[model samples]
Target: MSTSPHILLITPPLTQLNTPYPATAYIKGFLGGRGYTVTQADLGLELVLKLFSKEGLRRVFAEIEAGPYQLSDNARRMLRLKQSYLNTVEPVIRFLQNKDNTLASRICHSRFLPEASRFDNVADLETAFGTMGLSDQARHLATLYLEDLADLIKETVGPQFGFSRYAEKLAMSATTFDALHEALQAAPNLLDQMLLELADALMAKVQPDVVGFSVPFPGNLYGALRLAGRIKQISPATKTLMGGGYPNTELRTIQEPRFFDYIDFLTLDDGEGPWLRLLEAISCQLPVASCQNEQLADVVQNNLATGNRQLATHQLQRTFLRNALGEVEYHNSPQPDIPHAEVGTPDYSDLPLTEYLSVIEVLNPMHRLWSDGRWNKLTVAHGCYWKRCSFCDVTLDYISRYETAPSTLLVDRIEQIIAQTGQTGFHFVDEAAPPLALRDLAIELLKRRVTITWWGNIRFEKTFTPDLCRLLAASGCIAVSGGLEVASDRLLALMEKGVTIAQVARVTDGFTQAGIMVHAYLMYGFPTETAQETVDSLEVVRQLFAAGIVQSGYWHRFSMTAHSPVGKNPAKYQVAPVGPEPGPFAWNDLWHEDPTGTDHEAFGPGLAKALYNYLHGVALQEPLSFWFDFKTPRATVPRHLIQQALQEPGKPDAARPNNRLFWLGNTPELRYEAGKKGQQAVLTFFEQAEDFEVKVPAPLGPWLQTLLTSLASDYDTKVLLKDAAQSFPTAGGQKWEQFLLSAGWLTLREKGLLVL
Candidate 1:
């Protein structure tokens, strides 16, 4: 018998996207390093793609027709135009998948495809009617077509049906296991049927000794449990396990036996340590089970009888396992927490790279980052550096703990990832990447001559100086998103955000000046936030856009969570608990009420509408009260607050140039050299800067090289050619300069060639 366990890592249904979530990738990499034969399957993306195919649509329409539920007008129309849908479904999917650009013109044509209720919005029509709008229209129509089918599935098959989430209604804020258990026992929907088929296919292909389900969100919970139950039913010998963000947060106090009926073990926090120990325990018992032809329970009992008390202990540190009596046993691994460097590079080899759909439901350019392209997700650190936010789950391990690998290690990982995945785009999925760590990483990336476009979340703090921002942009940073939540200094202080409005404006302005796009994560309705404060916060947000400091932003209403400081001590913030605490099954998003009696819920729609208009540059001068339907007290915020903050304290210097250069093209010619014997690489380049020519070892040299190579070029080629004679040293120099100028190596500036 093979001593090595065959582990199959599964991403459950409804979390489909252009790229797989990083959970399985991280787990796969960690386990693979330990010499385990691991395979991963993204049943989520597969299920959605399958359901949207021509044959799948036909089955859906047939199901809708045969079902007893009342059909919406859109559903009736889809049934009527079933033939057109069937004919266009695959082609539409191909177009959306970026497989066939030729289908775009066909799909854009109004008569080529059927439309439904999702196209009823006037904004969607406007987008469809805009210049070269056909592709956009086609994508929207395709999304609508899928949504119509999803609705049909939801109405007739399962009420919880969605493309990215299934049975979420039964999972979110589920205080008891009864709802989820009842959901599992209920009739299978179209989604459930498709997931079961996928589960069976995966099990047959891998024939694994262990199956691990990664449940990242509440929506993925039901599908994960359902899949695990099916796996246990068909292959009773397989050891089933569950872990991920949802389980780490929700299943902490697991009193429910029904959960164990599906999976034998539930690991928490970082899965690396617990998983290793669990595998070792299983491997030790496997031989006994094989010899006696006994079930896993007997083997477990035999191990316990033989004084394997460590594995038999119910209160183990990080792992919750099942014992001989079918009772859940919690065990803490004796192993220390794995270092960040040892987690290994996230392996994306098992995922279907090309088949994932890049859906574009919203035409907003900034929001497109979530769905537009595949980004290799990586973490700068193990957890958050600042887990002090009152509304945050600061007590949780994922937030409370903070550890980071060296900058050299980070770049090494990046290089490895690039070689493995053949992709240069990365998304840092950190809770909040520390500013100092980012600075060091940026310098290291430049020193090693590594090049990649990346973006991530950060805290809008004063550490991000203008010079630092410029350095980051020089190192291929395109965009940055950070929390500017609540935008009011008083509430910001109360929330312990550690940054004021004035500070945020300056920091964001620095990023904007450095040619990087800025996206702000705004919040409203924090405990004790007044109506006037809410109005004033919108003013700050508007001024941020008006000053062109922030390009994109989103606002979310705050909800208290159990692990937050506010939840633990509600009266300190003058808020009282409104509902009973969440029970054993799931416990995030607790209800609370402010004694101040501010109707925070009423401001949501207006704030969203105002933001929508603000993002599109439609309403800048509109009154804060104008967004709200009812009479709202005029915003008391000073109109010139942002403008005043932007003005520097000292007088402008006549000798120093105020203007900074910007890169024009999407790509530039540059090379990074790694110096020998622990020395930094020497960098050489040309562009607009204080110095035009220089050679030095990194970290400073590479930054200058990147900056010089990225200067803006928007002038006519003929003009640059004509001016080359005056700028060059000789006739031959002029000719060479002209060639370089024409090739975008140089550009004409009023002062001189802007290079350093």
Candidate 2:
């Protein structure tokens, strides 16, 4: 057997999909590179799949019948259809898994699958989108079927149940350790029972020396701790560690002694460096002095003075360790941050890929991307390139410090991922992909001849030119989504987004023209945003859709985060901090009251309703005041603002060169040949640009070559055409010019310009 200690990395319950979150994969890749044995599990997806099964539903119904809990009307109705649900749950699951095509016909034809009050609006959705095909309808209905079962579990077992988040409300905005402690101490719910049973099987299988739990969200906290608590109870000698987004953010200032009872160590920031140091300490390779921080050394000396003999010899830097006195002590690490290029490609070899279920929750076009298919999640960089947004977590290292790997290395990692997972789709989970980096990546991908579909987040800035968008599309970019937060020029400038509404319209239009789908991340209710601004923002959104620059968008209410610029200086934004002021457990999303006195809260429903209708191509001509129920001021925005902005005026007599030939992977060639029928004119257009070649009039061939060469020289069309007038006869030049204009050989920038 290898001497290296076994490590088991786990993802807790309630993160969406069967795919493991990228955190475990990152740590696993790093540790594997360091020559240690690592095993990983995605318990979140496993538990969800296990619970939604026919047998699981049977057990759930039995628990519901046996328990003393009160049932909601929906839960009571589900009990009445218990037998039908038990019969159909397995088929629905198999259909979702793509294992049974025969069941699709049946599912589409009959109402055999049970529905719930949660799905009472399915009819409304169908009516709104028009009658979709049976496959889509079945998928929607099947989603509702699973949701109905989930609802029964929620109403009877745990009130905080959700497909992706369980007991989230209990953890959200939790200020003190006492709330989490009491929640952990509460009687186990049905979901908890299922998680414990799953954990029991996994622990028995892996039997790891060190079990690390990855808690990426507040909702995952309760589940992770509960699992750790069970591991401590069953196997007291096994060391338990917790780290990820939640602990990295919330547990940084933790002082709770009870929190360390189940977990021996809690790491912060990027887990790779700390994990290696921890393993070294555990293996007795790290010297005592090297492993110790001043605070931790003081705790250790104090414990020794108290005559404690059970203290472990292991010590860790950059981690919270438990001493003999049962107190958690933080140790600072002297290690420098690891370069992102050296972190290695995320490994997914240990995850079960085929078992993941693709869930469809909403019929909305924009919402389906979340649950539609499996996407390989990779980060293009370590942090945001533009971290100056006032509402963002600019103080956090994950956002503040931007670092990126070389384009060649990124493509190499992409190839490695394709070889490992046999999947060619990717989702770059970056805060905002830097434009220069994306351009370099697109070029490298083309040079390497790598074919993979990908999309990611970006800032709506001018760097994404029409040429760059087309190049990206040629390199297999299918869609892009970016923040267009608060859509008011004044608020945008205040937020330091670095892009105005006009710039956003132009950028989105570029993407659209390149045949890439566009989705906007919209925000409302920023500090000092009056009712008039909100209405005007909606007006701009309406024009963006009407002009067909953006196909989809989402509206989120502005939130104050602890690490944001606004949070650091509240008075700057004319807001005062409210209660739940930074405590030990959670330090995110600080509540604040805006002195501007606008009811930002009430704007959410109307904005959402209006955007929803806009997405479905409805009510575009309605007045801005139609969305809001309460009397709102009329929008002061000019109706033609977005249209004029999107129709950007070009320099007089200027022609923007189309890079389509470059994207097609070849150069154009023209040939003139005399035929046997008495010097007949023939022009042959041949190259590897596409699969086919075309023949044009011979008279047009020389003019086309001249235009292409002129475009390469970057000369304006007026200047080039004036030069061309001296070379060809008037009649021949006119015919060739008409052909070039009509055949898309020459593009004029001024004809379609919209004037406001």
Candidate 3:
């Protein structure tokens, strides 16, 4: 070896239970090829388990016994309520209770925490942190949820320190840890001792040149900073770098240089470029500023300030990043392509990869999806094309950062994996696999006759025709996942989602016809969504399912992410500001609301349950292919029976809530194998398809009528409407009203429609 100096790459645990998968592997590949010995540590997960380890638990229990900051019975009750998800996240709960990290169970606990209620308000967070006595950094970090902790680190530390480099997301994970923290009190000194012990172990064994900490989420922030401090205490000479999501977004406002005492460098933007540059500078004994120069600093500043807007709309003003000397900077070059192939096979040997958590061996959503066989995960592309969906975070990394790997390169990677693992199935982990790349990939797979099964995310566009879908299916493609954010056309337009509802229906039908499974992403509670509009969304879901288009769906409450288009331009989507106390990721939904005080009830539990029922097949009027594919049971009498049960001129609400067709077999106690309790439980029909069926959800019937009527009202002069001159009377009045409502012509006040 040339003694060229080695670097360690670390992915801080975004969630307590998640491991660093793609991040460590990809970074190892890039740096290892460049003569840098890179070591990655998933300290986030380690710390999470440490919290519940025997030692960890002893410390926590001791603290509770001592009663730090007056944590009374009420506080304990609240904490217990938060941790009520113990049954679901048993591994993590037990691990936390143990509070020891040396054990294998602790390590396993790092990969799976039960997800539940997120922090709601700044006060709620203040109370949480207050109970724990967290320092300022930890307090600030509590704002982010577990899923995004890594990215938050990148945003906060990287930008705050002024290291203006960008790298692609080497990893993608969806694990969250807040639910586990619900029952625990933050004990800073106890956590510090555990981290010190872990750090000492690393120094004794690995003797790594530099130890990097990946604190990607807010929940992990206190733990990350504490761990970073402990690492330094153990090995003073070993350099420490903090990167990931936290530093990327919040770095701009964090002015305290004291935070840098433990962290030598903070990587901003994408870690791949900046991290490599920082390593070179450190190894070569060059001034850190020389790596960024001045021009690049300016561009980095502007880019960080404006995010994707700088890349998409205003790059012409400064095409090349410039420094103080007016020299162009290339350190941050190749600003992450969303559709690129692996530069090389991820170096997983160094990581405790096999030792990390595996969901497949057990039963989970991922396992259920792969019940036929196990499959490896791979990314065909990165970034997104239709990043224009206002709800997306295209701006944070810069929109237009679209890139696709060559078909040859992708195939090579797949072949190498198949050969190595003796597995033929792969998961394409792209944000939205570009249409052209998908087509090219299909063509190449066919040409090479690579008999590998795969599935990935893609945009719901017209380009995915029946023939194309068929070709993909023939080429071992199994499922298609894409976001259909809202069912209302007006809301869709407001979000700048280019695809139309009709097009979505057609494309979904095409995928279904081609035997491709589809899992749609649905969002409720956008800024402009009125009570009727929200209801109308359910109607659209009902139609999509009844039409045999959608196979299944993942419904989410709409969130204005810090870097997404909608988050940046809230006014465009009618989002008004709530009081400005930052809380948790879930609080993003609370930012927007109706100021007129007319439709807040639309956001209540009823609509949420109604939509949940529909998505889970509890409210289905007809059995779609998705229900059978998921092996979900029908719970109540079929639609025909329900219709028969409905007496003429009678309302359905008169029936008992749980006795309704949708809730027949579904009880509060039911849970999914994924440990996703209420969220994942499906409404099953007991025996015959006719024994349980759902009605056309209340939202759709009304919204459809509104949309049509609004269309007629808007274009009345252009079309000859016989009813425009007088009171419109006909059997289709309700249909017209549904269309009109969805079309945005009538309001609740004007139509005098009762709120559901």
Candidate 4:
């Protein structure tokens, strides 16, 4: 190896539209600490920028001419619209909330939209500019609009809208390829041409010695491969390394050696330690046997089995580490062969710190839940705990366990980060937020008076006793997000969520009492969920609200992820494959084909409105305080209309009703309906309304009718929310219902229906 060869670190793009922690920064921080000259380039954000460029568009458009590009206008429009829609952040979030497998499957297919990408060999400038496809004027217009908007943004927001060197590379690996594919199909090989142009700019403007690409998402696997192929072709001398989520997760399954031919080398695990070692070897012209081919096979096998395994401590030490407070351990440590105490703190000097600030509009979204009012994303602690969750891909990239540093070590890392970057807040990007680690963290933070704000994911456990929660809050813990999965005890048992409804209620209450905001990560559409169970889950949530135990919430449908426990063992979960497999689940339909699948109706069925209503905090507007408020008419609303207003946005005000015409028409006495006493419940609610007529928009009548129809359909049988076609909005069913009730349009006593 040439003495002191220049090394380039790249971070693949991620889902974050704003700035995200770069892979290279972690590596570069490690390498730089070891006295190596490392430069970072984020290709992910660059890909997004390319989407806005004329040169990028023209090249892809031209390429379409050389291919079999027959597609319907609707499909093309869908493609273009999806691309544009991706510019915003909501679609991705909304997509994640949907549970319909049929819709998800169609979306998965559409990810390979036009199917033209496979035809172009290298997917390079020549291929991109030579393909044959229809003239996509709409795609062109979109490109122009985005570009103009980007320009205005740059001018108004300065570099804040751009990506850091590390963030750029991350985006390139994470999102660019997909974005390119969408653009290319709509036009031509715009993705390739854009890369070529960017390569030139980098070569001319930055003149870096090496170029690495981080490939994080499996959806981006193909595009990343093609982009790497093109980059290698353009600059033969520039070293190309492939790392990130793909290699880390797929290390074991990499049967094709040809991938090695395209990229010079592959890095895995945390990459920081290995990366630092490689840089040192290169800098000193040392023959490093560790990174050689003979050892690669073993590395691959171990990584694949471990799935997102963490780096060894010896590996960590080879890079850099600093600051220590407590001991660290790995739960399911992948590299037991490695030590932890020896690893050094990562170096941050080699990264382009300024670039990250441009795109950071606000701190990470989760930070908003914290009372400390600080912004932070995650650092280290990458994978999840309980990787074996039925629906989770535990055996996938970065989901495996790593050696966790002691609380002292964590504090040290945070202190170092604060000194170097002045980032005082943090978001521990963990899967389960293990109780032991939290206990240790609280001890350390309290001891050191870290004076920083933080938040993270946690499982609902009795360990979150009132005392522990109170201590956590005092130690700068602002909020905790728990994946309650489902509210039904039976469903919870089936999914192995480990927490009971009672436990959930208690834990949530504990957090709330401690004054920490609670954001619940709920899942509906579990394979065996029945209609009654779905409604029961809603009731549970209502109970939680009544108890004043939860502050905020988010929900998702159960998805069978690739390599996940459930995905691997579908039958164990009573989930039979009723349709084709779904694409990689993204908050948005990143790789989806039919944005709206043909079988979309089948996915929502009868539960769509209910699901939607539940998420928006309106399902059964009875807050945990509902009991106390019920007596005073403070927590009630016209429950029927809540579902209607949510689905039909800005519904014509014409639906305004004649409040005087409607009333709680009552018969002599309340009567219970068989075992359930359903009729009596209605009578009690009507009596509470005190002859008040509920006024709702005329358009909502249909929604009420549909809800009643679904309820009747379920009658005595347990109908899972998954089986229903419609989901209700939380805002509509909960908040709006409360509004009407509080407005005295509905009452609790008249029908004996109001439980509160």
Judged by whole-model lDDT over C-alpha atoms, candidate 3 comes out at 0.49
Candidate 2 vs candidate 4, lDDT winner: 2
Residue 194 of candidate 1: its Cα lDDT?
82
Off by over 4 Å in 2: 123-132, 285-317, 650-661, 665-669, 673-756
lDDT of 1 by residue, 38-135 (tens): 99999889888888888888888787778786777767777898898899888877877879867767665547777777767737455434876666
Q: Model 3 over residues 1-756: C-alpha lDDT tens digits?
A: 124445666554333232343656666766666556677676545655555334554454455445434444434443353333222233433322322223333232233332223233223334332444332212122212221222322332221110111221211111222432331224434444555576677667777666766655544454555566766767776667766555555442333344555566665544556555555444433112222334345544444455421222121111122333433332334443212453565555454432233222111122235322345667676557767877776765634466668888888878876765566767776778877788778767866768988888888887785556776776788788887887777888888877777777777776787778887887777776765565556666776665556767766777666567766766666666664444321122225554532353334454455544554446665443232222222332233321222222322222212210110111111122232221222121233233332222233333334333443233222222223212333333344344334322223212222111
Clash number by candidate, in order: 16, 0, 94, 132
Q: Each prediction's Cα lDDT score?
A: 0.76, 0.76, 0.49, 0.47
Please report the TM-score between candidate 4 and the true structure: 0.54
Per-model TM-score on C-alpha atoms: 0.84, 0.87, 0.57, 0.54
lDDT of 4 by residue, 340-449 (tens): 33345544554433333122121223323331122344443546656656666566545665456677887787788778766676777677777767866775675576
Q: Which portions of model 3 miss their true places by more than 4 Å? A: 14-20, 44-195, 286-343, 358-377, 418-425, 449-451, 578-604, 621-756
lDDT of 2 at 99: 70
Q: Write the per-residue lDDT of candidate 2 for residues 1-756, one digit (tens) a residue.
A: 115468999888778763557889888888888788899988888888778787888888898899898887888898999999889887787777767756766776767777778677665544644565656667777888888887778778767778787777777887777877887888877778888999999889989878999988988888888999999988887889999888776777777788887788899888887887677555432122222334345544544466442333344446887677777688865767778999988989788877776667875665666676677889889989889999998888788778999999999999998999988888888989988788778767867789999888999898787767877887788888999988899999999999999999999998999888888999887998898898899999999988888988999888887778998898999988896766766667688898795898888999998998888789999987888889999889998999888777633222432222232323345666664533323323344343333334456556645544444343123334335434544434345345445433332221111110
Q: Best to worst by lDDT, what's the order?
A: 2, 1, 3, 4
